[model samples]
Target: MKIFTARLRQTQFEISAANLAQCPPEQGVEIAFAGRSNSGKSSALNTLVDHGGLARTSKTPGRTQLINFFRMDDNCKLVDLPGYGYAKVPEKMKLEWQAHMGEYLEQRQCLAGLILVMDVRHPLKDFDRMMLEWSQHQNMPVHILLSKSDKLKRGPAKNSVLGVRKEIKAYGDQVTAQLFSSHNKEGVEQAREVLANWFGFEKEYETAQ
Candidate 1:
């Protein structure tokens, strides 16, 4: 299918929500990107949309402590969820963030799919497994991006992807994975194809011959 990647460049920041109550109206499809702190989530998102400053990357681990939404169109959006695990925040604040994220995951009706980003060097930590289990329970489709692939040699990066696939096989075909590099733009098109498919844009274009 031909997914117009150019349209993704049009994505603009819509709003930020500190809690579930602060989110916009739930009327459209939302694809959320979730990962632990310093997992390169923001970089991956910025690269995917071909925009340098769309998702707001930072040197600090816990800088993105709110739910940031980017509107792709009238009925489509990309959500950057608060980073979890190892953010230098206080225990009480971390707990509050976790509660908010949990509520957003469990209660959001418009969430079409999840793009779980993980650092290739540190794949599938406790946070990642928790998300996998939750998505499995909810029967939600998840596409895992082994981000920062450029940091590793090709052999190890490919192995990481293979290992993750084997580990998540029990969760069924709804869960998929791929190696990605925001720095080098490796696998950007592949990642975008997954987004296009999940966003239902594949139906809007004719299949490639």
Candidate 2:
């Protein structure tokens, strides 16, 4: 599949936009990754692309302060948005990020979908709910990743996924979710499959061994 091949190929670092005006041209389909600070967004991106350093994982929350872009191909890209709900950051900076993200979500025509990362132990925080509501208003599809699932046992992890799915049902069929763990690489393929669909990637069977 081209998507699988693109994942294996080197993913180029595109640009970091501090605001909508600084962003690259809105051309092809783009899938954005967003979540609260300390939500494992960087780790999930690195794991999703099978590249260790594709997205920087920082110990400190709110370290990612810009909209980082990774080019999967000419027609497809992945965006890592600044994390929200980080109280340690300056209030001014927090408001700036909030404004930037809000404008991008509302006005970016090339945005195809959103992949929201949340800790499985604490899913559906206020910020997450707000994002869902905004996406619903925009008629945008969302695929949530319940990160750090390996911290919980299989039963509890499954329950968390079910709980999130149930809660999002109120938002209609546009929202979906799944359990994920970057450490064990759980749900990597599943996440990729969902992303591939968003980008309209067709699986190539002839190359199969």
Candidate 3:
């Protein structure tokens, strides 16, 4: 249980498209967490780096209206894309999400990879599919963390991961299928290994740890 430590670091809200576009300039490496509304994305982020409650969690879907950025040690950034599948938000607002996310993913240069987290029991919904397609279109690397896997039994959980792996294989992504749990800290180390290797810092990470 020797987990890594990442403190609050710095968190800044980006409201306008202009601000979001300018975020990646300084952050040496960037990894993003994206999924449908209320998909446990924020919780996993807080758990991953041992920073509790980093991103706000809400029962209300689509609450994260803008792309929020949190800096770590002034070296890397954690990008939180807005949650899709809004039930109460206006049409114009939902439209804005599509445009904002589309622009960011397609244009960002320092985007090392994306953590496409999905609920294990209900992996790869419609909006998740669209996100996968976008990643393929942009040729972006993706690491899929099947969040909330602790809720499922061992047999079903592994089966779900296998199922998603087979389905998204055609995208030719350097993808991984791991189960995550904030409550019990499952998948924490494996995820760190994934990110460290993806960003070419695994050697340093291991050496330091």
Candidate 4:
């Protein structure tokens, strides 16, 4: 088949919204990347797009407090959601963020799927389970990116993947996962293929020349 890939490399910073009302029009396919703070979500995003600085990576957790959007083209976009489970934030602010995120997740009609990132060493925490539950409620397709796979040995990493798969199996086929590493670009192609499929990129078989 002649693969028609989404031009993710050409993605540009679009806008940041603190609430759903402030976000751009809900028209295009948007795949959102979400995770707990310090899960390397931003790094994974940058790696997926082959852009070093697409999403800002920070040593401090909870750096992303807004919903950031990156435009791949006129009809496709990628969203960066604020990281959850940052302990230092005030309770009021945390609740506000949660409300905003919930609003977006429940109301956004054009959101195609969600990329849930987690550190390979600490996969499926309470926050991750909460996200999974939310996804199940929404019937949204979710791709779990087990980020920072390089930290663990191959056997352990594979085992982690298997464990995650088993844990999420009850959620149904709408949810899928794989190990990913921003540092080494592991599973970048696999992730991209998922995105491409979600975005409905053209797939045409090549005829005999």
Give the better candidate number (3 or 4) by TM-score: 4
lDDT of 3: 0.76
In model 4, the Cα lDDT at residue 101 comes to 92
User: Residue 125 in model 1: shift from native, Å?
Assistant: 0.2
Report the number of the highest-lDDT candidate.
Answer: 1
Model 1 misplaced stretches (Cα beyond 4 Å): 1-3, 206-209
C-alpha TM-score for every candidate:
0.96, 0.94, 0.86, 0.94
Q: For model 4, give the RMSD to the true fold.
A: 2.4
Cα RMSD of all models vs. native, in order, equals 1.9, 2.5, 3.0, 2.4
Encode model 1's per-residue lDDT on 65-130: one tens digit a residue. 899999989988999999998646899989999999999999999999999999999999999999
Q: By lDDT, highest first, what's the ranking?
A: 1, 4, 2, 3
lDDT of 3 by residue, 72-102 (tens): 6455677888888867889988887888888
CA deviation > 4 Å runs, candidate 4? 1-6, 203-209
CA lDDT, every model vs. true structure? 0.92, 0.90, 0.76, 0.90
State how far residue 143 of model 3 sits from its true place (Å). 0.6
